[model samples]
Target: MKKLFTIFVAAAAISAAAHATTAFTDAKDAVDYRQSAFTMIRHNTGDIGEMLQGKVPFDAKRVQQRTDALAALAPLPWPAFSTPGTESGGGDAKPEIWADFKDFTAKADKFQLDAKALQTAAQSGDQAKIKAAFAAFRGNCKACHDKYKAD
Candidate 1:
């Protein structure tokens, strides 16, 4: 029992140390992770948009799959605005993030709603409905990026 307790304590200390070291210390690291996630969502969303616009042939199965993927990406955790001496991948995040956190969160929630609506429209297979919802989805993207995202 004594030996087992000692081994457990050592393992716990190592795990804690690793976790502390892996925590993001700078805005850049956080932003990098966010950008990677965004890229994945963007790729999937763009594919859906193309199908919706009829620029690409519509594939219900593909649309459903991509829509599900994009919808899954909603409600990203808003990142901290700035850390001393930390750059956010040349990000255009204004200081307003901290100053206007409530507004930022609201927009994030709106994005989730818009994404869900788009997914529903795509699944419904109504061309007109998909077009309208896709436009709304695109508008939400622009609005959020305009206000919150860095250039």
Candidate 2:
């Protein structure tokens, strides 16, 4: 009976470990989640830029709405690459993400920082500050996409 109990415990432990390792079931799901998050970030940034540039009149309500959307997207839990049977599968993600993981993470971090700055500028309702922050935020996006997103 003790031996049987030990075997059951071992099985449970192994199962838990397997579940932990495969936090995402498939590569496509991972890619889709990432793309969705990026879309949110991009859309919000574009909206803010248009308002800042006077292409669209500043709408405080719309600015706050987009800012909240971006804040929600900022905390996405990106998966690690090459998980067993998983592959990036022609997504915009460049191979350098896995090849140079540290640099890739740095770029992502910079993007978040710039995004926060943009949000702050928007909140302040200062046109000049908004323009400057928008430029800074867009620059980070361009830098990262240039290196880490496939054309």
Query: How high is the lDDT of residue 27 in model 2?
Result: 70
Worst 10 residues of 2 by lDDT: 77-86
Worst window of 10 by summed lDDT in candidate 1: 80-89
**Model 2 lDDT per residue over 109-140, tens place:** 77777767767877887778867877887887
Model number with the top TM-score:
2
lDDT of 1 by residue, 1-151 (tens): 9999999999999999765533155556566655666788789888988887779998888887887887887754344333443343455666666678788778877878888998898889887887788788778778877876667
How far does residue 14 in candidate 2 sit from its true spot (Å)?
Answer: 22
Quote each prediction's TM-score.
0.72, 0.74
| Number of clashing residue pairs, candidate 1 | 1
Q: In model 1, which runs have C-alpha deviations exceeding 4 angstroms?
A: 1-26, 77-90
